[model samples]
Target: MEEVEIEPLGADEARDILAVAQDRRNGTRWSVALALGLRQCEALGLRWKYVDLKRGTIRVFWQIKHQRYRHGCKDPHACGERLHRYPCPKDCPKARRTSGRKHVCIKEGQKFCAPDCTKHAPSCPERVGGWTFVKPKGKSKRTVMIPPPLIPLLKQHQEAQQAERQAAGEAWQDYGLVWCHTDGRPIDAGQDWDEWKELLRLADVDKDARVHDARHTAATLLIEQGVDISVVQGILGHSQLTTTKRYTHITATLSNEAAARMGRALWG
Candidate 1:
């Protein structure tokens, strides 16, 4: 429903973004941002098992479900945008329980409910535990080849992470994510934006270019360089060719030049 922004970075600006990302100590995320065009959420959810450095390919299947901000819904009918709209009240007294026993709200200004979800006709997933990682959009899965130049950078980063893990020993939480904190837990997607904005500012590029525009940059650059449309579509994991079209931005000068070149070859 929302129109996609046409904000592909030129080669120079792309280089600058990568340069600044390295300067800012976020080389891995920025490299993936430009090279593979991964959404920040997808990048954050990546596990080490999905990354094949030997083969220069990365698997994309899951994304971290963002759930820190909003809680359960007051609306009884609507499930709300988030599934964790309703939460099990851990501190409420017996007065709030679905059971005949009494309950009290120890924590104020927060909705509380018990696990006895029979209050709703069919019940809801919110009645379950909190939200965690979720499948990719439409559950679409794809493998993307890493850029040739980025393989070595990834190797170096992995070595550094290995050292960090060794140092942390026992304290490290091994989530097996490709990119994580010193504790080995996945990076928070919500926190990714702050670094991205700083990177854009340092690069001196248009600040309005959303982090998602990096994905568009990848898609558009590959197409302009004459890769087959089907291959581009597959790389983008787009179910509809039309969706790929939204991501592609063909400049008028390039289009006219292409037309003239074809005419010259055919007639002259």
Candidate 2:
């Protein structure tokens, strides 16, 4: 496998981002991601039942995944124009970069799709495309200890959510998610990403930082604090120590500390 780039926020940068995120509705969600190194799906799928405020632990059992729609109609070709697949239009704006399965209808070659061509499962009358909670694969389902400082934030978030629920009244559709929309609906992953970008912008941090980088930040921070590599692996729910090591990056402080330790040992 190709090496993955690991760019993590510094301590000050993380503080800035958290301080900005505090005013957002799902602020605690970001906090949990940073503190626990949770995958985006795990954090979004987290439910109140899995969170033990008294025990200060969170069981990461579920992940919110967007499953692709499949054709449920008996006669896909007979489906409406919206359901029929089409080749790239002559004036297609995305033609320059389109390729593979996303570009042209595989069955139609380079020609325009037949009027009865069966395609675009997403538009089928009985389509089934949406987000649903599913079990996390492998060791990702392990439990994580919540940091002491984050406990109060979680409580405050819960109280705020209760207020939102009351305001929503009959509109609320509780799925027991620790973080959700004001109406208790599951938050779309796209929306979650947008919020992360907005938080970075507000915090004046790296504008190009990806949301998953928060997990990298958590791993790096743990290693910097002298946490054992195996312990960090367990906390991150990684199946292998090598995977956990990949998420950690060496910082100037770590280098300086290593040099200082070497100098002290050698001189003494």
Q: Clashing residue pairs in candidate 2, if any? A: none
The regions of model 2 sitting more than 4 angstroms off are 1-3, 70-127, 247-249
State which candidate has the highest TM-score: 2
Whole-model Cα lDDT of every candidate shown, in order: 0.71, 0.83
lDDT of 2 by residue, 17-128 (tens): 9999888888989998888889888899899999999999999989988888776888665665543446677666666554444554334345434755656677787977
Residue lDDT tens for model 1, 1-268: 2135577787678889888777444478788877767777788888778889999999998876545433244553454322223543666444456675544433455543344333442245444433267788762579989888888888888888899999999999877777787878767655677677778888898758877888777777777777787888878777778877765445553587688999999997
Positional deviation of residue 208's Cα in model 2 after best superposition, in angstroms: 1.9
Ten-residue segment with the worst summed lDDT in candidate 1? Answer: 76-85
Candidate 1 backbone collisions, by pair: 72-85, 93-103, 93-104, 94-102, 94-103, 95-102, 95-103, 96-103
**Which stretches of candidate 1 lie above 4 Å from their native place?**
1-3, 68-131, 247-249, 259-268
TM per candidate comes to: 0.71, 0.78
